[model samples]
Target: MTTELRNTEFHIRARDGAGAEEHGPYELDIDPGRTADGDAAPRYASLRHASLRILRLPPGGSHTFATGDSEWIVLPLNGGCTVAVGGDSDTPFELSGRKDVFSGVTDFAYVPRDAEVRISSAAGGRFALTGARCSRRLPARHGPASGVPVELRGTGNCSRQVNNFGAAGVFACDKLIAVEVLTPGGNWSSYPPHKHDECRPGEESELEEIYYFEIAPAHGSAGLGYQRVTPSGASSRTGRGTDVLAEVRSGDAVLIPDGWHGPSIAAPGHTMYYLNVMAGPGEERAWLICDHPDHGWIRDTWPDQPVDPRLPLYEAPDADLRPSLNETVEAGPRPSLYEAPDADPRRSPNEAVEASPRPPLHDAPDARPEAHPEDPEGDAR
Candidate 1:
């Protein structure tokens, strides 16, 4: 990889069929008050190297989850949860939710392959939980799952999560990490210069990253954001130094190959929400972002700012981050190149519900590909 490609970069948003091969700029909305075992089966996918299955649970529901041979991270996007990593263990980890908190659930609980887990949601709301394996592909190392006799819901794993990734299991390259970074309403993240290459002194772990944002739902007309990424002076892709100041809404995405990034510029009228996923071939999972050397130590001279009180972990996660009405933004629009029209399980399969040969969340931008225009066989959700 070139020096510039080591810092930050973006992949084209996942088109309809794009998710089948890769994951980027994708969105799946959940129906409120729905549970996993509901009428339609919740979605599940074992990507080339990882398996991520999500289910919505109603209040007072219990489910068993297995991590077979993979390390997993279980997060309840909404609602309060009781999770026991190694079920049957005497001590279980508990997370409470505030009335104003997201769907009322605490953040994710890291679960390693060393244990089996069970979860319960007390408050009724939609819950999105994903389980992905670790390490590169090898054999069928199935983690424990939502096993039998649990309830009227299907005890068996779905047909979709049963494909063989063969040589592409979890470890192909580092996959994901959960970071609780505090970027006050109007601050930035990767400022002051830093990089994560060369396992020497400061910069350990050499991994690629993905930034997923979750803004305060209530930032009505003013909640806008943007990112700036470009090549550093010493290493430019071309003789010219080009930089991009890309503005973003809730679901937009940007690519970063090099340069200094920051000042997530949350427009004057609102705050912002964002999550970043990083994975690469390095052993260390810790983060060490390098800034423009000239501006590197700016962090030492910066003052800490307080966060907005009305965001997630505080109040209810607003339904959808609607489009801004009549506001002007400094950054340009960053729309996804593709979209998954039938993302919700509650919706009946329309023309956009076919299967693909690529990974689960990375495919084309239109409808799911069909076998042939002349054939219309088994096409269930």
Candidate 2:
């Protein structure tokens, strides 16, 4: 690979985790200016069909925009909001968004091409606008958090959590396909090494993928993980390929132009989370892939192994409550949303909400010797 390609293939991108002002193709940090106009101007023009922008709105703040030739999803990274489509004739769809991406499944709204949208939050929130240029215009709609299908895949150390909210066949859209994955500490996800960059008749479809990462913090310190993408070795019409092995942290991202990506590994004590945004030049909106032949045998071994016990990390809103620090023993009704760190309502644009360290959902059996028995600080290795 050329030096330019090699250097850009897979790498960690750092920004003010509190919303930096930097702008580039690989990642777009939250920009306050765009939030006022409902504009998230992503920099990767080469992505061709798709773009992503994160919108941060203060409490009682609102933003409006028109979807000219692209379809989009108002995916909440934190807090809840009301998404109003059309003018004033229809009832706005309400999204009871979660506290943070790793907390649980969140409600989302879909805005079709050529439509007008207005998003307003009673208590302020941050939203991810995942967009794709499209030829077909689908209807404006809302997807309830309760309707998201949470799937647990792989087993043993390869286990992971998948929130198939915008998955193909599960949700309708013109050309956008998205999903969220959570891999627990010491586990590996996106495994069996797969590739969807080839457009085969029925086996595979070429798609450009963006992975937005968020690593769970440990000991009031930073968290870490790893990601790998290898060249497929097959020539393509675009003739693009890459080989990448990178150490990733919260707010980092990896762009896959053409390669076999896999083994998104979480560090021994920090869970890993990634939001996948995908779109392609294919005629149909489908997620098709061919597992790397060398590692395809891994799937056959899944049935023999048991899934990790700490799975199904977060469930549908209506499901029975899972054990959490926020839950109460004598409660009549559990708090439905995770609590975000306190934020001043009148803060300036440069200011960001304080990010509180997320306490572990359950205790791990493989904790280190130095780990505190009660006030656990993780492995710290």
- Which candidate wins on lDDT? 2
Misplaced by over 4 Å in model 2 are 1-46, 235-237, 319-381
TM-score result, candidate 1: 0.46
Q: Against the unseen true structure, what C-alpha lDDT does each candidate score?
A: 0.35, 0.67
Local error of candidate 2 at residue 195 (angstroms): 0.7
321-353: candidate 2 lDDT, tens digit per residue: 323221221132221222111222422111111
For candidate 1, give the lDDT of residue 340: 24
Over 92-128, each residue of candidate 1 has an lDDT whose tens digit, in order, gives 5454433322223233444555466777777644333
Which candidate leads the pack in TM-score? 2
C-alpha lDDT of candidate 2 relative to the true structure: 0.67
TM-score of each: 0.46, 0.74
